[model samples]
Target: MLDDTLKSQLKAYLEKVTQPFEIVASLDDGAKSQELHGLLTDIASLSDKISLNLYGQDSRRPSFALNRPDQDMGIVFAGIPMGHEFTSLVLALLQVGGHPPKVTDEVIEQIKGLDDALHFETYYSLSCQNCPDVVQALNLMAVLNPNVSHVAIDGALFQDEVEERQVMSVPSIYLNGQLFDQGRMSLEQILAKVDTGAARREAAKLNDKPSFDVLVVGGGPAGASAAIYAARKGIRTGVAAERFGGQVMDTMAIENFISVPHTEGPKMAAALEEHVKEYEVDIMNLQRAVKLVPATQPGGEHEVQLESGASLKSKTLILATGARWREMNVPGEADYRNKGVAYCPHCDGPLFKGKRVAVIGGGNSGVEAAIDLAGIVGRVTLIEFMDEMRADAVLQKKLKSLPNVDIILGARTTEVNGDGTRVNGLTFEERASGEIKRLDLEGIFVQIGLIPNTEWLRGSLVEMSERGEIITDAHGTTSVPGIFAAGDVTTVPYKQIIIAMGEGSKAALGAFDHLIRS
Candidate 1:
């Protein structure tokens, strides 16, 4: 049963649904099925426009019997939808109940015009904040086109299929039996994959030789800021990235972006892209920088080779490649990722509000996460593998002041224990006594360290720190004259969004200075 606040909100939303829609539950007499039935019944009770139907496996209708033979429009709930996925279920109902898809008109027209049969199978976990975006997008796509059909499967309920497909993360999408994408993706990205044949041919025939005055290697917050600043100078600027938004996309809520009180990662990422598009900056998405060849002469252009058999040349370069979170490589850790194990505390902390959680590592990041989560969650357990905590004295003092926080030192995480659905507990061993203990927790945040995305820069002239971070000066200038580094990938003292944006601006100004002097 939902709380009064949530039920009120859902009832209000359902009341606005004008069209009639049916939610079908395909299950036998099982506890999971019974729970799902109850949830659907409650949802259906909100409005007369919504109806709930139940069918056993033997009586289930074939996919071909639906509106479109090639597609199945029957919305089925195979298991209980809780956590973030509850939003997916509600949104699906609203979308199917006559709410228009929140996409561009051209995109809608393109989807409507498609005649080929397209089916999508998306696997998601209830706790994964990012999974709902992909699930909702695919569901909306199905609603928009008769030729397109989609099934949103809870990964925990379908562990066999997950293991068969080797899915280690949430929002693992498969199109027509082939893996399309494994993480959060926009609707346009999914459409591109649907037209894979045409896209491949187009990519092969693309022969345009691109050149720029200043080229940014990454499309994260830092790189986006650099490109925006450089483009404001009216110079040819280009930004290439594996994806825009970088680590920000994985983050949930961002409150420290300066001036803005609170914002989500995906929202901020979209804003960054929208702001960048306002300028004349050339954006290349889904492109990875493979190699960097520095210029031979002072004013000569440097070449950036890409993994996609494309190249871009520029007089100055800004390496804004971002960093990723370090993982805890223990049993069930990868399997339960997004299910219960998470990395970005800011993004996922609110999801675990009033629940018991744990923080791995006793470093500053771990301590900070514990402090932040203690206010929201009921209880927080801080575990350190070392004999003592490595966080600062001030942070330690603050942590000690928190009554809800429990600290355990010299504790090594042995394994993450969970049902096939979500994490319930974890096993840890004390170093001194070799005694094993278990803590029943709803979620675990791993914040040991960060690894810079600078592996491709190996053997290059750019100097790197012992930890592989790109060494940069106060002005964001690297060892090479025309090259500059910024953001978490560089030797910056902090890795905040505001700090990265400032560094990006500094790097862009530095590049402009070098370009004019040359």
Candidate 2:
């Protein structure tokens, strides 16, 4: 299963294992089971502390569990962890073998202190860029607490389970036989959900923090850049965000991030955070900003309030809050979201494999999603309200070459129709005529655009565009003297990662200039 170079790396990683463990696999007489056996054998060959047991009593075939020799607590992977989850496999091996996780010690202690037993099952797709994080986090939790157990299942490989559970999206998690969540979630986010008092504790901690010279709201590319620039000026810099990566974390392939030929969103987001950490920026993740109060006078402190009932004051405030996927807002769309209506084709495309699906929009994202889904789903229907596709000419040409794809222009999506549990089809209206049509499909992918994260700043003194995006001058300075805005949350012409970073840097400089003059 693993190549020669991969084997060398695995051997080196296994060398760090200080404890003995076993790979207990439950298999049947099938091709997939044979492949899994070969993989386990290859991994067991890397270190003397690791042993492989091919026979097990578990009913789930092609599944393996990693456990310590002295402990009954272990984590299970029901499907082969390849592609994006290969990192997860490596981390499980090391973590279950008594190696420390990359999370903070406080979080580690919190996981270990949990007394309630949790049986978690995660259904994920190999192509999903967001699945590895959730899977790995749960695996680490299982390693930390014996009361916590998790099984990571591949949705594509286990079609029966996916259908029985009505899973229409990747990274669907079930806890104690009930649906816990769907979509990407961090360790802290999961903990906050499970631990009832975590929010109050976090709020108390945040409330005790001192004021900062430059405080950045949001933690996307722009926020990271602004925080770094501010910290470099020997000013106290802090960053509060709902989650450090913003919408970029949900993005798939990013090809235009200069210098680097190609990269994924999660990888780039991690790199951005790491680069910012090289400075003196104090990052507070999982904190959502709900309100922003402008400074009373020049060089005075502005307050940013969080949803956790905590607020922080800053001398100069930089609002780099990014945007989110624009929803259709049609009837039943919200009710069926994650049940069948998904925004990320890269994450949820595999769930609709061998089934019909529709992509709503004519822009580059929509065309690209159709192109990617053509190879996975049985049929791809691209519905657009416009007369022509807004995608690049090259993308449109390539989309036209796909045999499984059907393009319908001048059609607007109307409603998402679903059976009680999952979506079955949707209705659309013809632009030229008053006729309404329906598409019999299992999934709908929305790729229209984004809505800025500036709704929280409504009625504030800051200038803003009609779209709710903060308006700023060339210096990235908002109408308010001590307040600046950048990134997708602002009225920037181009909403790209590089552009956001440049704007953030400019805003930091502008804030400093104002600070000195005041």
Candidate 3:
């Protein structure tokens, strides 16, 4: 298995590398040292098609990068492929050899048709053992289709990036240019978001506005709930949102909300809308509040202007505008969106049943979605670019226990793949080994992070957090008198529907009190 030239080169290199390591063998019998020597020898004997290199510390890992000759399969080994790490090592090597372990044929076909470049970046920590499931989901998706690619970043290694990206927790995914999801996800759930992101990006380029009283800017659960409560209070309310339903719409389900055992983001949004319509809330969907110049006061009423050349006067104003998904702005992501793209699992998971899907991010949401989709899809793959998962210890334990989950550390998605009709696959490059491989998948789910949508009111009377989240008092009052804000747009700890609804109701009542007093 060892050619003379390659063997000599590896032998010479290992002599220096393994000096500090525990050497179980010499140039004679097969032991730890000899095994490593043999592995390197095999790498050298392989054809030029295989790209092998070292990652991490040369003194420690001394791994290799393997690339298949025909398929876009590849692997980057950071440590010796034996013992506890052997399964991961062998499986990764097999995937590079065009033999993905358990992906179904249907999922593979769906992935093959994808020509777009799917790029994903996953973030996690080494301390998180529950991260493997998310990685496996992405891998299955990649195996079935070779168009999508993935990258797993170790949070501890990229400390600067983690802080710069505002990664508050583990298991965060980024799809295309924006933060997709921020928790656990399944293969199908990941695919669903990819399709939804594609559809919206293709058709949703602008925001159209309409008329109403007490116009609310954000559309998070709080803002939507505010509109509903305001309408119920016999107040004419107009809710304008850049993305309807705000942060809650991006969530997969709601477990803590009262009166509902479990509810998905879109379902909760729809119900809230229905309730609002029962009163008198006019929803201006897909419209963003780009400007918020306080209208000239007349008869003690305050008026505001909109970017769409519209103006409205109301006795009170509620800034319920929510947040936006953060973006990576990395190369290749924008060119192949929707082809093998995504952002929200609850919005599009069903489209990828029995299909391979990738969930990027190593946070709670990323883990949760991956687990949920595993039950319905043929396979679920998760890619965390971080060294470990940082989810709550309990949740992390559950993720590790899943049967179909896979985890990849120190990798990143460099491209997306699709053939125009839908998504096909992805390409991943190892940050440490510099090995690039393509994965085929029907869909991808991104769970990166959220950005508060407060750009319009940057210099306004409202105070804001560093992340652009609106700042509010205990009573939902903004810095400006007669102005109140609530929901995801504000700096609330738990961004849930029930919490938003309660906050929105409180803001509406606060506005009413202000109006009465004024």
- Which pairs of residues collide in candidate 2? none
Give the alpha carbon lDDT tens digit for every residue of 1-518 in model 2: 88999999999999988899999999998999999999999999999999998877777888999978868665999989998999999999998787888888899999998899999999999999999999999998999999999999999889999989999888999999999999999999999999999999999999999999899999999998999899999999999989998888998999998998899999999999999989988899999999888888766889999999999999999999999999999988989999899999999999998899999998999999999999999999999989999999999999999999999999988899998777889999998996999989889999999999988888778888888899899999999988999999988897899999999999999989888888
Give me candidate 3's TM-score against the actual structure: 0.52
Q: What lDDT tens digits, residue by residue, belong to model 1 across residues 52-91?
A: 6565352322111111223346444434667767777777
Q: Residue pairs in steric clash, candidate 1?
A: 252-347
lDDT of each: 0.80, 0.92, 0.60
The most accurate candidate by lDDT is 2
lDDT of 2 at 288: 94
Stretches off by above 4 angstroms in model 2 are none
Model 2 TM-score (2 dp): 0.99
Flag regions of model 1 displaced more than 4 Å: 1-119, 144-147, 154-169, 172-181, 188-209, 327-359, 367-382, 390-408, 411-445
Better of 1 and 3 by TM-score: 1
Worst 10 residues of 2 by lDDT: 65-74
lDDT of 3 by residue, 252-343 (tens): 55787887788666567657766766766766554546666554453245555555444555667898876656554545456545334656
